[model samples]
Target: MRPVSVRYDNSSVRVCMKKKAMCKIGLAVMLLLTPMMGWSAKRLNIVIIVGDDWGGPYASAYTGIYGRNLPSNVVKTPNVDRIAQNGVLFKNAYVNAPSCTPSRSSIFTGRYFFNTGGGAVLGGTWDFTIPSFPLLLLDAGYHIGLTSKGWSPGTPRNAPFGGTAHYYQYFGTSVSSFSKSVTKWTAKGMPFEKAKQTMLDQVRGNFEAFLADRKPDQPFFYWFGPTNTHRTWVKGSGKALWGIEPDSLKDQLPVYLPNNPEVREDMADYLGEIQALDAYIGVLLKKLEEIGELDNTIIVATGDNGPGGFPRGKWNLYDFGVATPLVVWYPHSTGGRVVTDFTTLMDLAPTFLEVAGVAIPPKTDGRSLLNILTSPLSGQVDPQRTFAITGEERHNAKARDDSLPYPARALRTARYLYIRNFAPDRWPMGCPYVAAHVPYVFHDIGEPSPTYDWIITNRSIPSAADYFTWAFAKRPAEELYDAHKDPGQINNVADDPMYADIKKSLAEKLLAELKKAGDPRVIGDGGTFDRPPYTDLKTVACQDTIPLNWAPGSHH
Candidate 1:
């Protein structure tokens, strides 16, 4: 509409006047919108659902294998699939470390695992001095609460980080009791199927209770850490609860695992646990919707690391060990898209802080994913997100008297994975002698699962020997894989002359990035990671004399 206009002294002055008028109008609109936007300008209720030891490929939505191939089996995750349909699914998400403590620490602090002092190792204490995103949210006036596992499998005793302060006091069923409760229910005349369902329901009930207790008018942050996908699943759970018979899954076994019926059954059980977790996620989503907070809340569902207690999966630098499924749903913005940008758990802390309008600390190693999250574009939203860095320090302290650390740093790109084993002489997994001798040992493969038993029992067989070697044998100093050509990462092309240039470039880049990040391994103080005052009583003993020409300052 051609309305009355004021004349200006010059065109530039008129433009400035127009901009000032628009700014004033924007400020007035923002002030009016403040109440609906919560206490702060970017206040958003955050719900992060973390599945313990779950991997990306297990998600039906990511692979489309669960529903299409195993329709009769009840390991279907229609609910989680729904989230992917309604939100942004990240295809190339990973954790900084494959272990529990380090992975969680990275997510909480927005720092690399190696940079986190004691947090770099399993059963080690997290340096509470590093700021946690949840604590920051709490200080920002958001009601924070966590259910099931939080930053755990590690002691948070005297640390200034005050573990309890991160979450508001909320009562819920303990995740530790999940096994006992299922056993008790089964013994009390309930069918194994019904008992398993009851156990999952209890977890969902805890989350519901947390939501119910949230104060009105206060934005909330809740960490829903579910133990459903963790190791030690009830034996025969797949058949008992989900009708997923072991024999029925012969054709669907993953390429990485042995195709025996036993391994298939284990896979089924694992899938059942993931399905149970997905069920709870569905319940949580429904609860949010019922309470009218779904639109305003940012729901992020991911796993801490890869699948646990499997060969070459968890506690290793393989893709299966570090790659995680990341699905983020913020209904008000950025939904129904698939992002292939490389993402690490380290990025989550800064992302959460950014969403809450809180300042991200300067020392953080992670870059915020706000741009990728809110962008309309799909694959590779950020050009800089081309690669992810992953490493491992000490996973299980109960391996031997030495509690040796398996230190390996890896750089993963869309095309290749480059790994540098700081101590190539040390076993990638634990020493086989210690593994065979130690009763109830928490070796690199993790808890005594069927896969561990199978590998150990069948080690004499040629095929089993090959599998064991691939999973546990000592690796070379430098190893590289063409990830695109070899998704299983079984073939090593590091020494292959054809790929020398790629290997050299990646190695140089990896070293530069590590140095820039202030990684202790690159610095001269890496030896401190191996020595003294371990949280576990088992001391770290060097089996061989430290080599005269060994990498200086290298530890566990």
Candidate 2:
């Protein structure tokens, strides 16, 4: 084509004018695209789903061995499995503490359980004031909404952030508050309908509503912590409700029972709850997809602690207790990848902030795994990030044999697990074993069932003793296990002659991490817990094991 030669007058001027026009166009394009890129990097919609008192075996990624090898008996966590399948599934993940409130507090604050100073479960209003993870996200321009249990049974009103997440819904049917709710089912039966209603009516429904209510702000962070599969078992009519049968699930037999029928049934009911929770999670996932946020959203699904009330499950420093499943899904990036790194609950807050392109506060101890998710094949992780440490303060005090307090700390890695018991002689379960007429916590153990009866009747037998004796048994300053060889963590190989070198190395590593994490209970120094008359093991005397037929809300 013949072009018109119109720029012959003032040739230098024309050249300069052309260069200026190109510069202006470049600047305009940059101005427009820069914001879009920044928005993409900064805009993150996060959903964290924490299962109540669950462990790694419940999730399908880790061999799906909750109680047995039966596939039909396993927990059907399709939504949770979806997270693992879509993102990086951390095969070796752990909670900083094995107990409820303490683990959650550590997770939120990115602090060790010892520093939190509240113990395993919250006792009262004074116990609530710990730092929160959501508050930090809120400060970083996130619209935070919590469905069901967020930061705790009690609020962290006194911590630096000082305020709680916008708790849109409280899940489960329990409404006695976090403290009394523990005692609500002191009798033999399941929890009151109020407890179940709270979950069905409020927690699940509220989560759906919360999803529907989002306005697409700068970014949104939602905590969808559920109360599914916690306790007070419910069995649906003929078919099992939650894709599990308690008796059919695998039972680890916590140092107490040797594969008994009664215990199997109880375990089945627990699995039912897990299955039911899984279905609800599926609902949430469907909602996310329906709202067109599924592809861009980051979904983290895991458990708060281990199984409740079993030996070395919920309250102890064993892998069976502190080890949990961590499934992170970033549908837009790496999907269907499995990561074998050992991660911690404390890592959550920092990771959330890091993914959103926000500055991580110096006070936090957790390191972000965003890079790992974004570049799964590169293995991008801090070389220095090694181990996760967890601590415990108390369990159901009213449910112990000797009435002694249990205090412990632990460190875990891909290969090893180390436990340091501060109160070595104390019972992991509460000492006195309260025998109140009302539904007492430990009275459930005193029931006439075969396993319970065997445990109470044969306290003299080492294997048949209650959890108090099992927990109160002799312990070393350090106990280590090679998790690769011993996933169940039954054999105590800390003193084995063959693994002496490994033990020494793990001990040194544990001390270094504890010190780095600001744990005061290093070596024998005993952290700052010098409060006089710390919880006691004073026993309450009673006549016989409480009856199992006690009515709801009645004396045991």
Q: Which candidate has the highest TM-score of all?
A: 1
lDDT (Cα) of model 2: 0.57
Q: Which 10 consecutive residues of model 1 have the lowest summed lDDT? A: 1-10
Please give each candidate's TM-score.
0.84, 0.75
Candidate 1 residue spans exceeding 4 A from truth: 1-42, 64-75, 157-162, 165-180, 191-197, 398-401, 434-442, 533-556
Best prediction by lDDT = 1
lDDT score of model 1? 0.73
lDDT of each: 0.73, 0.57
lDDT (tens digit, per residue) of candidate 2 on 460-515: 65655544344334466667777667655656787899989988887777778777
- The residue pairs that clash in candidate 1, if any, are 402-540, 402-541
Count backbone clashes in candidate 2: 28
